[model samples]
Target: MKTSSRLEKAIKKLYVAFHANELNPECCKHCAVGNILNNTDSWKHLSNDHGSLELNYVGKVHQTLGRKFNGYSPLELLQIEATFLKACGYQLPLHHKNKKPKSSADKEALFNGLTAVMEYLCKLDNINNIMDYSKLFEFENEKPKYQLPY
Candidate 1:
C-alpha cells in the first residue's frame, strides 16, 4: 500500500523511536506526537494544556491557514498525543496527580500506545489501519491466503 511521503516518514521515525526506547508519554518531546514532529516540543504551543484537543489562539490561526506540521494539523497533533497518553494509561491533562500507570516506561504499555497512535494516524490520513491483521486470517482452503511481507 502506498502512503504519503509525510506519513511514511512519520511512521518510520516512530517505529525507530519505539524500538530505541525513546518513546515516552511523560515528556512532551518524546511522546507520540512529539516524535511525529521530529522530537520537538513546539507542537505543545498549539494547545494551552497538554492532552487538550481544543486549540489555543496560535493553533487557531494555524488551523485557519490550513497549516500542517509534518502532514498533520495542530488539532490532529493534539488528538494524537491524547490518544497515545490515554492508551498508555495516563489521565487527561497529564498532571502529576492524575491517574497513571505504576511504570511509565512499561514496554507492554508503550507498545500498546504506539499501536493505538499508529492506527489513529492512519485514520487521519483516510487510509486502512496498518496495524490491522484481519487479512492474514483469510483462507480459501487449508493454505494461508496471504503471505506476510518480509
Candidate 2:
C-alpha cells in the first residue's frame, strides 16, 4: 500500500536529519529515531532484518506523536512504519540479532536524526506548541522512563 503524503514527508525529513548529523544514536537507543537508524543503518541495506523492531520503533513514535495527533491507533502506526521501511527497501523480520559491537557515535547520530524528524512531525500535526520538542535537549531532574537499568 502507498504511504500517505504526511508519512512520506516525515520519512524524507528523517533522512535529511540523519545526513545533517542531527541525530545521536547512542543517546536515543530506545527512541524511535535511534531504533530505526541503528537497526537498519539509515535504511541503507535491504538485507537487515527488523522483525518486531519496526513495531517497537513506530510504537515509540506513536507514544509521542499520538498525544498530539488523535485517531491513529498503535496498529496503524505499525503499518505506517512497516510501509515506510518497505519503501526504503527493507523488511520486518520475525527475529534477528545485532552481532556487531555497539557504537556510541552511531547511536548519537540516529538519535539526533530522529529528533529532527519528530520535530517536523509535531509541527505537521500541530502539536509543536503543546509539546516543546526542544525539551529533549534539556537534562531532566528525574530519570527518563526509558533509561537503562544498567
Q: What are the lDDT scores of the predictions, listed in order? A: 0.90, 0.40
TM-score of each: 0.94, 0.28
Q: How close is candidate 2 to the true structure, as a TM-score?
A: 0.28
List, residue by residue over 93-139, the lDDT tens digit for candidate 2. 32224332244236443444344445444554555432244555555
User: What is the C-alpha local distance difference test score of candidate 2?
Assistant: 0.40
- Candidate 1: tens digits of C-alpha lDDT, residues 1-150: 878887898889889999999998988899898898889999999999888889999999999999999888888889999999999998998888899999888998998898898899888778999999999998887988999889
The clash numbers for all candidates, in the given order, read: 0, 19
Model 2 worst lDDT window (10 residues) = 42-51
Scored by lDDT, the top model is 1
Top TM-score model = 1
Clashing pairs in 1: none
